[model samples]
Target: MIGFSDTSISKIAKRASVSAATIYIYHENNEDLLYKTYLKIKGKMSEKMFQGVDHTRTVYERFEAIIRNYVDFIQSFKDYFLFLEQIMNSPLPQKWC
Candidate 1:
């Protein structure tokens, strides 16, 4: 899901040992799956970003720690970062604004 367009529903289903129809039960289409996956990844990233920084620190300090965490995550997960970067560069619907 992170790699986005390079993969097809059949590929994902086969990789997960499920049928394509089973995937449809959870997502209407590839874009929907991508959106859901993005949310999941973002949540995990945020959790990691806030893992060890002291809450008593200043807002700026905490934000800097988050930036460091974000950079580390991108470096560690280049493919996931690239997929999100591509999606962000893509044209979005007016409703998204």
Candidate 2:
């Protein structure tokens, strides 16, 4: 429900059966919405990376599981994964970089 394409606020409002003002009430601006969406995606990625771990496992096994989980998470959310890759590769604000 969160991932919207390159559409205007009015279009999104109509699709969601809400007013533009309602959307504004929830998000200060389009950038705010995008940031929130990114946070949601990042949280999901973090959760997936920590999906399975047992204290009894060997250290090597735990490391391998973590790597596999990260790969699986990236595969599951490829768009968000690509977005992250772009951010990391781009020259941006010092705070962001």
Candidate 3:
């Protein structure tokens, strides 16, 4: 979850009912954690957004499908979409990630 940047991994582990070391095994730091989470969310968003969209449709229909699916995806995963927007607009996130 892309919570505040100051959130501690230890706290995250506690909330998740996992050991701090377990979190470390998957992420070296909060940036890494956020990066991985963002990637996963983005993948899911794309997958759900494109599902059943027919490429054979005309340009206008295809554009409509894209817009409709994007709206549906954002509504279904509001938090993830917001996180992505925040990351893209802010300087806190490192591009190297």
Decide which is better by TM-score, 1 or 2: 1
Which candidate, 1 or 2, has the higher lDDT? 1
lDDT per model, in order?
0.79, 0.74, 0.83
lDDT of 2 at 69: 92
- Tens digits of per-residue lDDT, candidate 3, 1-97, equal 5446668898889999999999999899987897888788889888877887899999888878878989998998898899888777766566754
Model 1 worst lDDT window (10 residues): 88-97
Candidate 3: residue 70 lDDT (0-100) = 91
Between candidates 2 and 3, which one is better according to TM-score? 3
TM per candidate = 0.73, 0.66, 0.85
> Each model's number of backbone clashes?
0, 0, 0
How much does candidate 3 score in TM-score? 0.85
Order the candidates by TM-score, highest first: 3, 1, 2
Candidate numbers, best lDDT first, in rank order: 3, 1, 2
Q: Model 3: how far is 35 from its true place, Å?
A: 0.5
